[model samples]
Target: MWKQLILLAFILANCSATEVKKCSDDKPFPLAVRVLNCEIPPCDVIKGTDMIFEIDFFVMKYVTKLTTLVRATSFGMTIPYELPEDVRDVCTNLMYHAYCPLYATEDVTYLFKFPIGNYPEVSVKVEIYLVDQDKDVATCFVCNIKVKKGPTGNTTVYEIDY
Candidate 1:
């Protein structure tokens, strides 16, 4: 028993002596876009009609949270936003959100609301990244949204560690 205790103490000491590198490095809180009451994307729309949308996101910067970028691409579709200038170095190694319809590339927290007119069933991809690219690590969180149209929207929140 005495030998076991001594061995445990030695291990503990070594662990304490080792230096830990924090990815965030004492950065302040980050501004994360809080997507709330997001309704299931609306059904196919007719051409020449106007659609209005409202999006919400919380922006806090320097916060220790992950930010996501939304990407939309197709074989022959003209996407509005070109890829950002900085992500070319690590785009291939990106991890993506399995269910997000759009893919993301930047670290910006965006609440996007746009009108969809005369478009076919469009598919999207969502990807997230660590704001500090040097860390070479990726973290992702899952959020839930429900929309009831008109005036009442239902939503649920979940916390995940990555």
Candidate 2:
């Protein structure tokens, strides 16, 4: 039994985060997020391609006041996605208070059609932030993903769903 335990420990230590997505614990805002699209963490994405993300989360607060901001980082570069300026004013209150906050404060599903830049085959970490109008981060989320390399042989048009 002891030997078995030792073997298990060694295996766990050798495991890489590439096979698992590492997300930071919720702070300031406590929330739990579920990736609705992939089976594992560090979702597999093809380099120099576009990927889609679907997520469901619940926030521990009243939806009366908050701002949502999304940012993606890879190869030490950060990309920020914000509410479109043209419709920001109209959508401000709509998203923040879309649901009746009598019970759950933040509960929604988001869809992101993100482009995977020319970053090499590496691990990409994405951060989602919910902040107040004052620029204070209300809640933060981190998701680890992998960027796969392009195929070396002939590629099919149907296989271009990177």
Candidate 3:
């Protein structure tokens, strides 16, 4: 009888824990992450063999105001689906807001331009995983993006649903 009561209590406690909503607690911004088209006024002048893409990630926290910004170490490819790589160089060097406050929004943009030797199709993806400072462990926010390469390369917007 005691064992049954303990088991029930454990189950209840586990179920009562708060489930982290994807990107919701972090910010009030649009649930959908939209990357607008890449446009350079004079299409002719901006033409280059290798295309450069800009990616921005916004952080919105719903819980305690976060004080530290975990340095992003790596990111996974979205469209082509490649393995994760060290993106510290791209993120740390070019981020506007490295760290964000609780419930506040911060944007980080990376200039991703790769040579188009054989691969014509261009797709950019950045997955953001939240790390707990105290625990020093990673949390699965499970946020990812996959943007298609456009013909004109004017404005390529990728909308991340979920």
lDDT of each: 0.31, 0.54, 0.33
lDDT of 1 by residue, 61-143 (tens): 23333323333344555344333444322332223321222233333332222223434544432222333333423333222
Please say which candidate is ahead in lDDT: 1 or 2: 2
For residues 89-138, could you state the per-residue lDDT of candidate 3 as single tens digits?
A: 33432344543332335445443343223333333223333333343212
Q: Which stretches of candidate 2 lie over 4 Å from their true place?
A: 1-37, 59-106, 152-162
RMSD of each: 18.1, 9.5, 17.5
lDDT of candidate 2 over 1-162, digit per residue (tens): 999999989665433222223335634533334442454677777777655543344555444445556677877889784544432221233333444332345465433345666776888787766555456555566777888987778876342221
Model 2 C-alpha RMSD to native: 9.5
Best by lDDT: 2
- lDDT score for residue 79 of model 3: 36
**TM per prediction:** 0.23, 0.49, 0.27
Ranking by TM-score: 2, 3, 1
What candidate 3 gets wrong by more than 4 Å, as runs, is 1-49, 62-90, 96-104, 115-117, 120-162
